[model samples]
Target: MTILTASAPRDEMSGAPDVRVVAVPAGHPYVQRVTDAAGIALLPDPPVPGAAEGVWWPPVALDPDWIRANGDRADVLHVHFGTESFAAGHLTACVEAAHAAGWVVVFTVHDLTHPQLVDQRPYAAQLDELVPCADALITLTTGAAAEVRERWGREAVVLPHPAILREGASPTVVALSEDLRVGMHLKDLRPGTDGPESARTLVAAVERLREQGRHAVAEIRMHRSVRDEIARDEVRAAVAGHPYAVLVEQGRLPDAALNAALGGLDVCVLPYRYGSHSGWLELCWDLGVPVAAPDVGHFSDQHDDASTASFHPGDVDTLTEALHALLSRHEAARPGSIARAEIIEARRAHRREQDAATATAHAALYRRLRSERAS
Candidate 1:
């Protein structure tokens, strides 16, 4: 119940000044959640012209002209997402335009590797221009901060990712029976998500567990692009004969349906071949779902070792063993016990507090950076 406040730091050159920030892609959930808590005013991103009605194509945040025109509206330019669509040269010019208008740049390193990009060079090039130019740099993990120092030689301010789940929203607890449900969500199968191979591996693992009398089910959820395509024919083929294993072909789920789907599962598996940190992992954490994630990135770092099972992607044997371990461990935990339910609720409460603290830490950092700029 703490109310945090941040007063605009006075500008040294201009005396009393207005401190408003233009967050690139200001509508993002993560951006909105933190900024709402940080107590800073934000200038909304203008709608992209000549594009899809709902989508911001060639985002105004990426346009140098937009930055120049709105320079007076914001004292700082905080660039988050919506830059991936921009070319490296264009991104650099966008940053330059902010500077030219005397606006300080605060770049949060949300992704070391852009989630959708298979190619790393372009994103790397964009980082090269933005990282050094920023007056302050922010990142979500200590591991990422170290990587930033080693790669770009910049000491970034480390902050935890704010929680995605709403407060007081408890995860629907499924009565633990012999039947176990594990899920691999492949919404659009982003560049890093190797859905087809991971789905096959999970299905095989579920069958193996069932053969041993563990009684588990593996579910593969995919969008139409992946399900209808012949490239993913293996996924269909893998689940064909299995009654327990199911291949669900559905369009992108709305938030309510997605939340309900996630809450119903006993364990959620992330099947990324390569990537940086994940907000999906955070969501899993918030919902109190045990995560079986690849060893590729910092996904495992978000939770204690006991809560998360790690396996190397493409290593089918290891992945299968990991899945077995998850089922075995859960099966051993006496389900339907009040103690177990209390433990689960306690974890959820802890996550909510962690999220609030993260927001407060970010607000304090912003105030400090602004003070440093003023001095």
Candidate 2:
């Protein structure tokens, strides 16, 4: 059966004509939330019909031939993350195929710099291919949009990130005593994370806090993958040497476990030495977990100054100071910590409105692109 047809279904409630979008990696939470919010119906992601059986995400969805063959499946092809899994040339081919098939192409600028790469050149090349060709562009922050304009001469619609934790999904805030729990998660040890350096600095800071009679502890959590990738002995020794620090090694946490882990922390330290805006930072905000991030690529701009503690990357003293300040503020705000109910209430309204706005923007863009293609 064809994926899209002239008789494609309309919204039963609104009676508005609808279009099906093929989000590159439709399963990602960010993609799901934004598409739902935009009121956009997405084509179900499977092996693009006759494509290989096990090739779920990359190469298949990113393939130009797939875009051409499955043109009926999507009124628009919306590209976001997953470009890193393929070469820049492949991305160019996919975009070209969409245009050749007269399909609307929309791309969301999620990463200014690829998170896993030490150098920015490859991602920059990818952006060079995508930005100019996309029918519509979206990004999360005004800062990021401005960069797109300056760098690529493209204007992007700036949309706020929808709350990662769905509204009314229990309270994110947990009551805590005077003891402060600071957490640093080294997940699979991405190149962006300077784990050892950050660990050393954080441990020292936690120890100093202890000396000052503050009940502060640093919990360094690592994915099991780190054990094989890095020198396990060195990592364990770094965590063990600090009496105030404890290392926990586990495999990737499922969503529930991940939420629980983040919710349990008083402050979540984002130890990314370099990179662009982070979904982790946004998730922390949703959980009412304050984040301490290095002053890199719009991390500090993602939240209000009060919500995020920013420090210079690789500067132990700066990170130590930022953590100390955040902890002090936590104490100062005693009896006034964020409540779960408050976060839920705020998120409910924000999520509803933002989702609507996102939907409106996407619908409008799709309609315009469709109209343009017809003309």
lDDT of each: 0.73, 0.75
Across 24-63, the per-residue lDDT of candidate 2 in tens digits comes to 7787777777776333677756565565654455536778
lDDT score, candidate 2: 0.75
Span of 10 residues, lowest total lDDT, candidate 2: 1-10
Query: How high is each candidate's TM-score?
Result: 0.87, 0.87
Q: How close is candidate 2 to the true structure, as a TM-score?
A: 0.87
Model 1 lDDT per residue over 1-375, tens place: 222345434442344323566787777778877666434566676787776665654567667898898777876788888777877688778878987887778898988888787898888898998888888888877778888999989988766777777766655555756667788888777787787788887887777777777768887888887522654676678778888888888988876677667766667889788876888888766665677899876776656547679888867677777877776665543334454466557766776676676666556566666568667
Candidate 2's C-alpha runs over 4 A off are: 1-17, 37-39, 48-55, 171-175, 211-213, 332-341
The residue ranges of model 1 lying beyond 4 angstroms of the native Cα positions read: 1-18, 52-54, 168-175, 328-344
Q: What lDDT score goes with residue 5 in model 1?
A: 41
Residue 173 miss distance in model 2 (angstroms): 7.4
What are the per-model C-alpha RMSD values against the true structure?
A: 4.1, 5.0
